[model samples]
Target: MQLIRSILAAPLLRSRIASIAQLRRTFSSSTSVSARAFKYVVSRRVKQKPAKKTNFWVKQHLKTGRRIKYPPYPYGDSNIFKRSNRGLFGGKFPMQGHSVSSELEKKNLRRWLPNANKTTLYSSVLKKRIRLHVVASVMKTIKKEGGLDNYLTKDKPARIKELGPRGWRLRYAVLLRLKEQEAKRLRGR
Candidate 1:
């Protein structure tokens, strides 16, 4: 309250108030100069911070620093994994198999099941072909489901293993692509 009064009681504000009161007295000499404006100044002493927030403001502030507003790959909103992430932009590239071991695994099983190649799910014997299979399976699933917007990242497994080995493989491939897309979008912006 003391700080509030000091800011409002500045000489500039006091002179402005006095000038307004002088004008009011000139216009209506019958009215007291001590009235209306003095009460208004005391009541509105604190110039509260602006409450209007926009998407642009958030994006602008977040983008000002090296910080990336998007969540790190395979995790939640806050960067609790800051200790673990040493990479450029902090955990953007992802550790080996982290995406699969983390979130998005269950999403693959639930959304990609209809079109996924069950045989190539974990075929380490043919690594290249298996990678292709996962990407193809994801594309097929995306097309079958209409588009990528349907796969909500938040719907991933609370316990990752239930996504299964095949689901894990597929999830990693999609996670890579999504990371690439995000990088490109940020660069473009």
Candidate 2:
């Protein structure tokens, strides 16, 4: 019975020792592989080629000389480069500012203002002229009425009395449009 017990213990100890040795060998080999991989990565990054400088004249020459060939046109002798007589916004002038409300009033105000060169005047200049006039007039009216808060509380009749009939109408329209824009902004529109 003692001999059998010793034999069994010997085999178990040998197996345990063999497993420990295998584990150590595996761990050592994995660490070496990792070290080699890190070195390879570092060496590869260091050995990267420097970027070549491009000549501007050479680039320009290449661009100008290289014309892409297109298939021949089936239709004979059409002038593809001719400018069309059509204007933007279907021949009507485009509105200048971001404010979408009171467009008609803006257009009327623009027409009322005199232009230095009517034929050559741009829509932007016209819009700016109208905007300047409206802002100045409204500011004058506000100042005359004391303040904005006071102006708001006053009745329409009293406000009209402060500014003349035509002046009051224009100021009222401008202020109303401005208020609409502010309300739109507040509502996240």
Candidate 3:
């Protein structure tokens, strides 16, 4: 019985060495493959070059009378190729500061008072305290003339209203005319 047990243990120990040798044959090689192997093995993974991004805005928006490539936009963007903008209410210019409530009257008003002295004009704006739009137009003109800061600064706000309402209305009118002139200027540009 002892001899049989010894014989069984010897076979088991021998199988353990054979198993280790089998593992070494399968996975234990640390030696790097020779560079010469690459000569025969063609690289299957061709370097996948990246696709380029397209810049198509200029071609898309060229000012031509051809059929449009995109849908119309409700808001006019300088870059977009679109038609008239849509609004819930009609007859109102989408641009601010122009009131179409009484277009003809407004046009006449522009003719009636074309110029108001800047000093007196700015003061009237402070007084009528009309809608902020009137003030904004005057400020816009002053800015265009490169003298808004000179005419009215935070420190001079009080002196503005002392100029009176008539003066302010006249200033507002002059601003409207100036804007019209500027519009013509831009159209020519």
Task: Name the weakest run of 10 consecutive residues (lDDT summed) in model 1.
Answer: 84-93
Give the RMSD in angstroms, all C-alphas superposed, for model 3.
25.0
lDDT of 2 by residue, 1-189 (tens): 997778658977779878888888754544655355454444334677788753221122223575323233222222331111111011112233343346464422222221212121112211212211223444544468574434433555644343332233333444544565688799995
Q: All candidates' lDDT scores?
A: 0.40, 0.37, 0.38
Q: 1 or 2: which has the higher TM-score?
A: 1
Cα lDDT tens digits for candidate 3, 1-189: 997778657977779878888988864467566623566657687888897542222122224644324433223332221111210111122232433445465522222221222232232322222212223344554566464323333224333442233223333344544555688899998
TM-score of each: 0.22, 0.20, 0.19
TM-score of 1: 0.22
Top candidate by lDDT: 1
Candidate 2: lDDT of 76?
Answer: 21
lDDT of 2: 0.37
lDDT digits (tens) for residues 1-189 of candidate 1: 999899778999889988998888756667786765754455446778987653221223223454224332454332542422221121122233222425555422212122223232222211222322233434554457453333222244642222233233334445544666689899999
